[model samples]
Target: MALDALGSPAAARDGMLDVTRDGRPSARIHVTSRGGEGRALVLVHGAGVDGSFFGGLASAFAGRRVVTYDRRGCGVSSDALDGDWSLDAQAADLAAIIRKAGAPADVVAHSLGSLVAMRALELAPGLMRRLVLIEPPLFVGLDPADPVFQNLVRAGQALAKGHTSTLFMLALERENMGDAIRPFTQDELAFRERDVQTHADHEAGWMLAYKPDLARIRAQGVPVLLCMSERSASTYHARNQDFLARGMGADLMRLPGGHNAPRDYPDEVATRLSTWL
Candidate 1:
């Protein structure tokens, strides 16, 4: 999809929903099923953000079953004020969603969710028919002092300051946030601010432990399709994603725009999946 083509029309219709699981935090899964005979697809959001991150892309896949949800402590999910949230714990939450929703599923995950989904496969080997990972910031074996790591730390801290909507707008002035935040409310900036604060601690924990999941995913030998934005070439993170694509033997596909490809080019992503899947 062209950047302008992605508007409120493609944004996800979201709500609070839950699922059952044993000895684990109750799963808070969200759904956006447009109904098609294609493989059931589960969409997982990134760290510091909720299931709503997939709103645009999920809507684009209107002909297929698309499920998106908050990880523990974000969006409508339970806040882990003081509890467990290892990568495995997150994976267990995902497993519950897949089993409850039933099978022949393709799991599409972005950023941090990509790592969690990879771990979920170890918990249940055949849980998914395919895996689509969008730009996971996996930095295993890379220098922590690398510019990319430093940039992430800086961005996380800025996001932690609770100015997300404004900051997001400033960072990507071309994006039409006016439409994107509509289902959210006229004061959607406030909602973004609250969402940012909701996961502060979880974000911190995830950021500190982020690097090693790359090896974990690579060692698992799961079928994966890693996507990068066409503009990813300009940044270290995108280059890192290219490195990950090479290491995982995963398909290195490109969407129309930059880092926020899902949001920026929902239609293109949808079209790509239509052909790729």
Candidate 2:
């Protein structure tokens, strides 16, 4: 990747850093760093998306160096996502991003990225000085026997048959997210198509692996900010929000828009983040 500076002096410089384990390539994370002297701020995007999703939060953190990266298989990174994609592997990738950012950084993650960030904290707690999770779907306060799980299972089955649009809409309906996602622009829909299956793969593995025993981690261990959307449709997401705030003693943040608040209301979310931090 070219180390060419961005058009603006303050624009982040894009690069690719290899995150390896046992001297083998684990992942090639695509990163953008707005270099600064202070501790870095790393933003991890959610499922079916990449770091560009954090474009809204960029200027809000101008004074400090902020970094963003694509998770494995989601964007321009390596899709070495065969077999079971355990949360451990994803978390290790996150930790590597932190170390590449010069370590000891503040982390802000959204959706599935929240799960990765939390596990990263557990893997290398010292890398995070502060953490923020936005509408994490940890499935707390959810019954294992609920039909929703079966619906989700069926959705995955549909994905295996190369039916993306229907599977996606079904997921939105199940979350009560409505038809707002319909009428996608050509480019937006293309991006989603590339992302949805990788997301499904990760979700499948996450279900089989992580136990969602979030209470095992405590608020006292690290400073945490728990953010939620005032309009998020998923009841399970809300449950996780409340559970994390109460159990982790996290600072509660209610933002505009729904589960993908950062993407929907970039300016508002960025402004709030600036004010809070």
Q: TM-score: which candidate is best? A: 2
Worst lDDT window (10 residues) for model 1?
1-10
Which ranges in model 1 have alpha carbons more than 4 Å from their true place?
1-27, 30-32, 141-145, 150-191, 211-221
User: Positional deviation of 105 in candidate 1, in angstroms?
Assistant: 1.3
Candidate 1 at residue 238, lDDT?
64
Clashes of each: 1, 0
lDDT, candidate 1, 1-277, per-residue tens: 1111111123334444454455544545444443344456788876556666666787788677677766776665665533665676678778866765566478888766777887787667667888888776565634568765555555555666865554333333322221232254232233455456644544544543554445556666667788876766645446476567766667867776666667666777889966766
Q: Kindly report the root-mean-square deviation of model 1 from the true structure over all alpha carbons.
A: 7.5
Candidate 2 residue-wise lDDT, 94-205, digit = tens: 8887876666778889888988998887667678878888877565445667666555556567767757666666555645232243243353344565566787755544
Any idea what lDDT model 2 has? 0.69
Output the worst ten-in-a-row residue range by lDDT, candidate 2: 2-11
